[model samples]
Target: MNSEIIITKDFIEIGKLIKKIGLITTGGAIKVFLKNNIVKINNVTPQGRSTKVYPDDIIWINDDVYVVKREK
Candidate 1:
């Protein structure tokens, strides 16, 4: 499913975004999930959890595509 996330700030980390978006229950789960899954940001797979997700960026996790929107 396709989803849109409205961010009130500049950017959010990939891991943090995952948790914030309710994709995962906790930050601890991100490590395990990332190890077995892929998080494609702007059509590119991130190499680490530190990848910065900014507004207007498209992120793909599993079968879901989440579009990030900025408020400012």
Candidate 2:
């Protein structure tokens, strides 16, 4: 099953997302995680950590996938 997160914003950064998903604990950990893994948004790998994730976007990290859903 895919992991899911609810948001009320237009977008969220990949680093922030890493923490939200509980995949990485500290802010510094994101750097190492990103260096070793790729963040795929909508099935496409993003260029860098600043990649914006919107509602209904599919994000892939490590061996899992997360679905971002907007909350009204």
Candidate 3:
């Protein structure tokens, strides 16, 4: 299943976005994504909390790829 929502400047942090959208647990967000070794940013592993993720950015976690996009 797929869903979409507007990010209205409030969905800044990944952890917050994960919980705010009822996507997953904050702990799972940290363990699976925040680890960098598991998640990929722009096709490469990102190692930072301040990784400004704007619209159209593709985040890959395991076999699932979450495509970021501005609500238009």
Candidate 4:
């Protein structure tokens, strides 16, 4: 599945984005999920949950794709 997230801020953390989009239920699960799953931002694997995702960034989690866009 593909999704798009509109953000008003300059950037959003990878962990928060994952949860915000309903990928995971709890905040604590982010670490485990990132460890077990393949997640990339703009075609590069993020360093960790603290990775900043800015607008126009593309996130890939397994086969799903998520695009980040700025709020207009």
User: Of the candidates shown, which would achieve the greatest TM-score relative to the real structure?
Assistant: 4
Candidate 4 per-residue C-alpha lDDT over 1-72 given as tens digits, one digit per residue, 9 for 90 to 100 = 888899989999999999998989988899999999999999999998989999999999999999999999
The lDDT for every candidate, in the order shown, is 0.88, 0.82, 0.57, 0.94
Best by lDDT: 4
Superposed model 3: Cα runs more than 4 Å off = 1-6, 20-24, 27-33
Candidate 3 per-residue lDDT over residues 29-72, each given as its tens digit: 55454654456656876555455566666766566567666765
Q: Which residue runs does candidate 2 get wrong by more than 4 Å?
A: none
C-alpha RMSD of each candidate structure in angstroms: 1.2, 1.4, 3.7, 0.8
Candidate closer to the true structure by TM-score (higher is better), 2 or 4: 4
Each candidate's clash count: 0, 0, 0, 0
Clashing pairs in 3: none
Lowest lDDT 10-mer window, candidate 2?
Answer: 43-52
Off by over 4 Å in 1: none
Task: Tell me the tens digit of each residue's lDDT in model 2 across 1-72.
Answer: 488888878889888888888888887787778878866788887777677889888888767888998888
Summed over model 4, clashes come to 0
Candidate 1 achieves a global lDDT of 0.88
